[model samples]
Target: MQESHSNESQIQIRLVTKQSEYAVPDIPLSVPANIETAGLNELLNHLLKENKPDFLKQKQFDFLASGELVRVSLIEHLQERSVSVETTVEVEYIQVTPAPQPEDSILHEDWVAAIETANRWMLIGCYDHSVSIRTPHGKPVTSSKEHKNIVKDVAWVDQQQPSKGLVSVSHDLTGILWAWEEGTDKIEPRVKLRGHERGIDTVAVSPNSNRLATGGWDTNLKIWSASLDGDDNGEPASKKKKGPSDISTRTPIHTLNGHKECISSINWTNNHVLYSASMDHTIKFWDAELCGIKNEIVDQKAFLSSSWSALSNTLLASSADRHIRLYDPRSTEGSVCKVMFTSHTLWVSSVAWSKYSEHLFLSGSYDSTVKMWDTRSPKAPLYNLQGHEGQVLVVDWSNSKYLVSGGTDNYIHIFKNKQIFK
Candidate 1:
């Protein structure tokens, strides 16, 4: 009799959802107080199964109690939030993102240090002192062994052009501009950017494709004017091999100085606004048109990488402290960090925001893993990707259908799944 009474203990709860197909009655439900996430999942499934007998496959759900994910027992969650169990508790439900399937793994001759993808092409930089343009299937399109040292970064200056323009920076302290048509097998070097005193670590192209931003170990950011109009004629630079005397050299039109240490990454939100991350533990928002620093976000740990998300209107930074953080650049109260993801065991080297979803983002870490995260669920990651044999150096989500990552393992890992979107 005592066991029966113990099992009879219950709490009053109300289930809700924005999805009309999974809607249940709006009335309060009396459920076991000790029911955990698994038990509630099973109960919800049973309720839906009875209403629609055709629902044969049990669907998984994430429950939210008091606007937060319910990771504990029903009563425990209420208690922690200081909610009274006697009153009807409102709980929300949403479907979880399916585990992304492994799509492909492309092998490289050297460590793949950087990656950028477009609708028709993919660009990669390697430690082998080469930059290559390849198809989505990993077929080599064109490559350049022009950089004297390891290629640290690469960017597509114009993605819409049939003849694409690109910029590459290297540890050799130089940045090169190249123009190549889609079907061509040769990467023609156009301009040599010479100014940085030390290794150039990162490069970013403006949205208009008329300017380039290069940051380096010298703790300086340099802007250069890029004009690929001269190469628009039918004559391809690939038709003839160009020597050192053939290419013209140019220096930065404007140099922005603020960071105290190596500038690790750069991103342009628009043609005039720029953001830069540095090893000195700061992210500076710049007015590129005026060549001035408008504001800065200070942190405790050195940042390794940074990205700007126009969808979320926030700035993301990967740090030496092994975490990915998001800060609102519009915040006037000292640009406080709004969210922090702390799943990676080692330093997070890179982070890329999804172009399609405001909530989805990717992170690569020295722990040799890449994790898919959603802003809604801060306590845990949506999925953990493990394909790299060594520290993951970069990740890219420029294409909506695929998430790409590369690392010291000398390979590019692709993850894809149709069910990733609601």
Candidate 2:
């Protein structure tokens, strides 16, 4: 033990480990206030050698203070946590667990274009012109009938009914609504929506479940009523009673025409705010309440997919240039990307933020891999998940525990990490 000077402050540190037999001293150790974490780690390794010489060489350890990993220098961390020399800090030594591998793979018949999770069900839209709903355990629940062309995207309606509803858009130039019947594998087509002049690329259901938005190759974003009782203007049909006849006849309430190229993706952050990405190399933020574009972000590279962070004002867009750009809509700079993550060797086709983590996100690319990124470290992905044999088109973080990726190889890969859940 080093002697402390009169001017040097002292802090008591207690080492806690997972092993029951690896007993640390009952009393805390007095250490200099300005000691760095690396110095502390070195001291701990030396102390461990007396009782367990091989432990230090066989396993790696992570230091945690108050449940947060101690990544910064000790002095910096102390200042950030307001830890004075008079306070005793509890430092925990935890073994660094390896990332979990893919637990299972579900094979598909065609390329998966979109994926969404709700409750216990996982929905997938495939190039086979159909949408499938399955269990996270890879059990197929039901699938929709094939459309005229490949299915582009799928959205689940936030309905109160146990038999939830879903809407899907397709290259068939139409959107179809399906209703799942309880206790059965049957998914019945409730409505067929048609208005776009070309294939519809993506569809999103508003948070309130009252409105639906669809973007199409015709460079138009259209808003429609989620209910089957209304007309183009959202007024009830002239007939006294509504039936299946009124479903397919409904039109869009608004058609937002601004993009010079095909719309690739659509995301509804809230009931009133919608974000649309286009091949025109731009992203437009639309105010659904005012029926107008509130903001626009122009980029040199075309955007293939976009997703809003559920935990922050941040937005992520996967570009045709094979990069994922993070944007802060609240920034004064118009659409200036805050961070660029560029490990993907091919076009990034999809990006999804973890619903449970504010800064963690997942991206899939045409390079046939899914990369997990933490905004705190943008230079490299936290994990590069490689299993897909073809272009990975879509990825989803399911319940913050399972990571699912779908690709042109007609396979759905699921990954799990115990550390991620912690």
Candidate 3:
């Protein structure tokens, strides 16, 4: 099961079972900046790596806690050398801790879009001044129809985070950043990010939750430091960030200027590569650190305007032309190799990859259907899940097998094969 704690970044564990039947070449899962290094050494002994099964079984202990989240399956059985553990048990939280802060509201509404409470949820911005929140199971739990104007863009942050409380983006009343607590009646404007001479179109937080990146109609993608870099608790630092206002004040670490048209989507990759899919009918890759153009492909089949993202080392881009293109981030300069999958009848609205299985990904379209693709084959969809009536706007997968989807028709649907139980 996927789990995280507030007091700690990495989960400490004491393993006592003689390791067996679970080993594999390590995944590229490096420790993020949020992980805490403390207590690791203390817990290692509790894991108490031993080779004898009788000794371990007799002690009644066997578990592997990485302090790192594992999203994929292991190819090898975890055994002695292949296994390790943590045992120093000062105190740990296995679930979301009510972060230490103040009175907060987990959700709020200007009118009535909808509200959702789950790990992998979605919020849609309708052009008609409405918003919709859906559960990870693909059910609309909350929605609002009484906004002053239409909802432009939507994003989410850590709701369980006492400090990060109620993270969302909306065009409601002069472009505001909101923070509320769960089951509360207060939604306060935490920061007013107004640097975008225009409206904010999209925003994404890093997996580590220390940074915020936004792309907008102003034709620019800006990455900002959402919190201090010193600790995982996300405490405010005494050092001052350049600017007059606290929010929208920090200079965008990188300002991409190549897209001739509005950028439809942006995603971060494992190797620190940043990708932008633009209306200019091309997809470009940029070195995350160097901030220089690495490769650009023109005439990406139907990928004129699409929403796409990356997984591990692969990049997926969708296009209005009615096709999705997959590229290897490791492809060398002037030698980029790509495979295209033509399946959708209209613009590909959203794309997401399964964290547990990189080879599996999903795409939603204007045609009102969500299709799951097995990148292992790169040709067509393995499952054509159908339910939504209007244009499908957003789609995300919970760990690997469960799927969550949303559409413009004001409906949310969860799709999971019965075989998961089998």
Score each candidate by Cα lDDT.
0.84, 0.79, 0.50
- Per-residue lDDT over 1-422 for candidate 1, one digit per residue giving the tens place of the 0 to 100 score: 12332556888889999888888776798898878889888988988998887788988998888776787777777777788776888989887667778888999999999999877788999999998988777778989899999999998888666375888899999998887777678678887888999999999988888888999899999988766533322124355666733665777888999889999999998899988999999899899888888888889999999888878788789999988888897876754798888899999999999887777889999899999988766778889987898999999988777889999989999888556454
Models sorted by lDDT, best on top: 1, 2, 3
How many pairs of residues collide in each model?
A: 0, 0, 31
- List TM-scores for all candidates, in order: 0.87, 0.77, 0.59
Number of residue pairs clashing in candidate 3, backbone atoms closer than 3 angstroms, sequence gap of 3 or more or interchain: 31
Model 1 segments more than 4 A misplaced: 1-9, 19-27, 46-57, 78-87, 160-162, 230-245, 332-335, 420-422
Query: How does candidate 2 fare on TM-score?
Result: 0.77
The model with the greatest lDDT is: 1
Residue 410, candidate 2: alpha-carbon lDDT = 92
lDDT (tens digit, per residue) of candidate 2 on 92-114: 77555456478779988888888
Off by over 4 Å in 2: 1-100, 159-162, 228-247, 333-335, 417-422
